[model samples]
Target: MARIKPQALLIQSKKKKGSTRVSLATIITCNILVILVLLSLYATYNHFYKRPTSQLGEELMNTENTKDGGAVKKFDLPGYAIIETSKGSITVELHKDSSPEFVDKFLDLCQKGYFKGMLFHRVIKHFFIQGGDPHYLRAAEGWTLQGKSNGQLSTSLNSPKHEAFMLGTSKTKPNAKGFEIFITTAPIPELNDKLNVFGQVIKGEEIVQEIEEVDTDEHYRPKSPVEIVNITLKHEP
Candidate 1:
């Protein structure tokens, strides 16, 4: 075997050290890149699926009350409404603090008997049941109301999420909602910020669920007519 010289040995040791350093540097870079990718993925998951409730609360708080200089109204006590339907009655607690204008308009319509004998014209399983359309009520009389008393409420809280048993108003135009309202049977996050959530079912949630189970056509109109006999509002003392 040939004996290696000291200089050649030292040069070989230096080459080994250089290769080791390069390998360590490459490993550290790869580890950093992996960590960065994991962090980005976590952020994306938090943004879409696990968004914090505080963020949702902030959005609700930031909602613009567009009632045109009308002061934010507050109820002395929580108010509730009894929705007498063909199936059964559902009681909803109005969120006056969060949606005063919506609650006010709804109560006004109820007092005016606008929803009397109105059909739950639209219903979707695991989604919602919509009613309070005067057009449908008038249609039963062989004519149409042409959207009379269908005035929209401008100041209302946008529904950030549609929780089960929540009441929401339909938005026909930007930041405007009319007499059409709905009750949710499931969590519908897609309806967030699209509809105005004004109340939540405090009693007879089962009745709302029963309504959803009703058979409907492709257009979601109930096969058997489901009518709103009347809606009565009561204030809690």
Candidate 2:
């Protein structure tokens, strides 16, 4: 073969260098894309599947440490209610600061015995235990009333953390209605400010969990009736 020219050799070297640079850049770009995809997948899993246990603990601690600080007009007293259930009793502390109206209505209903002997009509494990539907209780008594108005207690969406034992009112309007209430069995961050969070369990969390873990029908109604035997209010001076 004829001897290659110096310029030709230099040009070939430059081409080789350029090709090497392009290959390195392609490899780096591919690695970055793979890393980004993995990061995105991790984030998605964290958001939907994985419970952020540490974060939840922090939030719970914050909620526990929260004080009323005269946030709303004080109730007649500061205390909780004892909900006597067939399974056990649970004590719930009303969040009067954030949801004064809802608390007042709940207290009024409790005092009126509206929740007496009401079945925990709906319960989902790791979710919530619901009751306070007088209609359901009446229907169980074979006295179904069609179009009979259930007692309505007006409420509004309140910004309270929906953690385990937090009480939420069923919404009839966008942000109103409080005849039915549910006690969360776990952190329900999705319901924050959507449901009227009126109270939280101050005692007997195990009882709440026990009710939630009870066997239920396809409609989530408890197979063995878990009734609210009574609700007795307490006042602290």
Off by over 4 Å in 2: 1-75, 134-160, 174-178
Predicted structure 2, TM vs. truth: 0.56
Q: Model 2, range 1-237, lDDT digits (tens) per residue?
A: 999999999999998888655577889999999999999999999886677888765555355322578453322444578899998888888777778788878888888898897888877666577788745332222111111123121132242376677887754443333377779776655555346787888889999988888888766678899999999888741
Q: Which portions of model 1 miss their true places by more than 4 Å? A: 1-78, 134-161, 174-178
Scanning candidate 1 in windows of ten residues, the lowest lDDT window is: 140-149
lDDT of each: 0.73, 0.71
1-237: candidate 1 lDDT, tens digit per residue: 999999999999999888756577889999999999999999999887786888876666566553648766322443889999998999888988788888878888888898899888877666677887655332222111111123222123343446778898865442333377778776665566456799989899889888889998766678999999998888751
The residue-level lDDT of candidate 2 at 191 comes to 55
User: Which candidate has the top score in lDDT?
Assistant: 1
The collision pairs in model 1 are: none
